[model samples]
Target chain A: MSGGVLYRPGDSPVHRIPPQVKLLAAFAAVLGVVATPREAFWAFGIDLFVVLAVWSVAGVPVGWFARRAVIEAPFVLLAVVLPFVSGGPRVDVLGVAVSQDGLLAGWNILAKGTLGVLIALTLAATTQPRDLVLGLQRLRAPAWFVTIATLMLRYVDVIAGELRRTRIARISRGDDPRFLWQAGAVARGAGTLFLRSYERGERVHRAMLARGWAGHMPAGPAAPVGALRWVAGGSPALVIATAWAVAAWPV
Target chain B: MTASVAMHLSDGVLDASTSVLFGAVAVAWLAVAAARGRIDVDDRTAPLAGLLAAFLFAMQLLNFPVLPGVSGHLYGGALAAILLGPWVGALCLSVVVVIQALLFADGGLTALGANMTNMALLGTAVGFAVALAARGLARRSRAGLLAVAFLAGLVSTVAASAGFVVEYAIGGQADVSLGGLAGVVIGVHAVIGIGEGVITALAVGAIVRVRPDLIYLVRTSETRELVAA
Candidate 1:
């Protein structure tokens, strides 16, 4: 499902880095960004610069990341309204009175939200989905949890396709799922969809049993990554850490 | 249209300490839920949990218009909790939320723990609690069952919404008006909760008709009491 759409095929240094290292680095970078105090705008700037530079190095297009970043729109709305509703010391900007604290909070949300989404998109863009499963297993994630995630990644697209067909069938029957009156049909559709999906699961289990499938999928522990790759791959987190420390020690 | 997963908080909205604190809570409960689900039905848990997670992912994509220009989809917690026990339901929803956050970017990665806590753990627990409380009425008739499901959906949704507010109050960096924020958010969700209730009722009703045994709450109870079936 995610084979073509979310993940892009690339051979950059970022892509070559093991998925486990990249996942840890992305997570740590986000922690650093979030932990950096809201007053430290310059530190946030350096965090953004480091993220963008990596995206460039990984050959991820700015337009691609920007388009996918549309998911953050709702958070942006919340951030924008904060300045208006916030009660604090007033500051006049653009000929309107706005709360200075609210303005800082708004910037905080926007900057950190952008950085978090971009960092995740980079991992998704660089690593294949299957590789992510490997990363999880290597990270000592529970086998059952990884098993569920793997099956979900496998089946989500098929189910979405089924949903598309179901929607089309509704439309063909002169049912517009868009109207509130048609919600009954939509719910029933969801109900039957559940049965279909459940039966599909049952069948899959039966097939596995018939094939003498073991209770678990074969997932071997991956070879350990090297120290140099750890430091190099973790550079994003390192940069944000330095910025955070610089901001912190001054206080 | 908001994916059920969209109920999540965005990154950096909560301070790092709050995020980490909630993260620990999420991981702790998730581990317990996984362990419990595994002990119940050893072999089928994987396929059931996996496909159920997929089912939820697809269900969230089916958004029905709630307003003139607004649409909302099933969070699917009540329905899932009613079908599978809370253990399986929580695990399934957690998987969906993680995938949505990681692969789709529908939710924030950094706030993954917080999202899992509210959307998956709290919602499923609340849903099942309501279902258990109304067990007698639900067993009597289909109408009663639907009503119970509706109530489950409404209360669970409000509970999850309240969760976000609590976290925001504690960890929010900006000194925004908490009262106003809570009102707007809870008020909108109250209306959306009605939609959540109705949709949940209808869906559960359909499942009851086709596969009565699949309803976990109704099943493990006094089988002789299931007059609705």
Candidate 2:
């Protein structure tokens, strides 16, 4: 639950936008970013600007976002290795000849990847988990998929809590997870936790049936987004997408 | 032992066509899985599968230290497939991947297809098949089951790395040679696979000791016996 990076309650304009529109807008922005040519460096810059604007408006601290975005560290390592290993026309930089095309490729990964992650972060920071499930349903995503997502969200916190408790119990019983021999204990704990969760799922399912739950999950009471809200929600993505399309066009 | 968790392919790493192609294939697989109704609300399987997804999500967050400053998390595709069968396992992993991308920003949205293909499709499918084959050859003894689980994890990680090489060959943004790239990727992943194998084997072994009937692989064996009868 501590890792609930998906949503933070807020009253910003971005937060007020309907979840479906936000979802669509986020998807559109990502498509625009991915579709843009890597050579269009200016396009990426503008994309970054748009993302930053959203961040500022949302009032999320730069540090908060930056810390979570550090998940990209591994990819950054791979990107750094690209220039030396990848072959192409070489250029001298800092007394070393590196592949020009590979340098561009690495920049492409870093720039576009950062923007994509930021946009996704914006979406997550605004929308609640429950709203996201409802948004998917409203967007005509498969009913079963939505149902499973809803159920999974409900129990993810519970299972995570159970994991923490089990870890504490193990530690209290002289089990050290850091030791190699304790690997078996840790894994066995995971298995035991999973089995308990599975049994709980069975009981939960039976309870749902007892409470008259049918195959279809009942829709939430949130109203669908109106056309005005759609335009408002989609405007940022539209602006970014147009910039991408223009930059991607042949000269 | 440095156990590197499976890395998410970032955006711009693959050409648009390659990403789209993989994305389409992944969606089709999901459709097939859905149509098969393997994860449908059957009063038992659906809730169990949903909980499995949540449990995997939580477990993935736990990074155990393997060496000095190097830690590894459970990939869990093999473990999921062994417990829930392939279709349900793939679906569960897919759910976890989607949530990670949408909620946590852990993986790129455009690269979701590649991630799912590597972790969900190839990892689970290859791991499950290899485990089943090994079980058949080893007479399904408890020790054999654990060994097979280990092999499944080891092989699946390498197989997913191979899949990455193929994808890179098709639409690699870098000008790196396929042979060199594949060598590096596979070699590194093979070592990481040892950790994957150990975790998967011990986890599966633990369940076998307590509730063998709950395991999908064990259930399949019982069904085979019933059909023979």
- Candidate 2, CAPRI quality class derived from DockQ: medium
lDDT of 2 by residue, A186-232 (tens): 88988898789888877787888798876657776877568898998
TM-scores of all candidate predictions against the true structure: 0.94, 0.94
Which 10-residue span in candidate 1 chain B carries the lowest summed lDDT? B220-229
Among these predicted structures, which one has the highest lDDT? 1
Chain B TM-scores across candidates: 0.91, 0.91
lDDT of 2: 0.80
Q: What TM-score should be assigned to candidate 1?
A: 0.94
RMSD, candidate 1, Å: 2.8
Give the per-residue lDDT digits (tens) of candidate 2, residues B72-156: 8888878888887788888888888877878887778888888889888888889889978876742459888888888988988
Lowest-lDDT window of 10 residues in candidate 1 chain A? A1-10
Residue-wise C-alpha lDDT for candidate 1, range A1-251, written one tens digit per residue: 55334888989999999888988898898888888888888898898899889988999889999998887888898789889889889999999999999999999999898888888888888888888877877777776778788888888888878878887998898976556656788888888888888888888878877987566767776677899999999998899989988987864
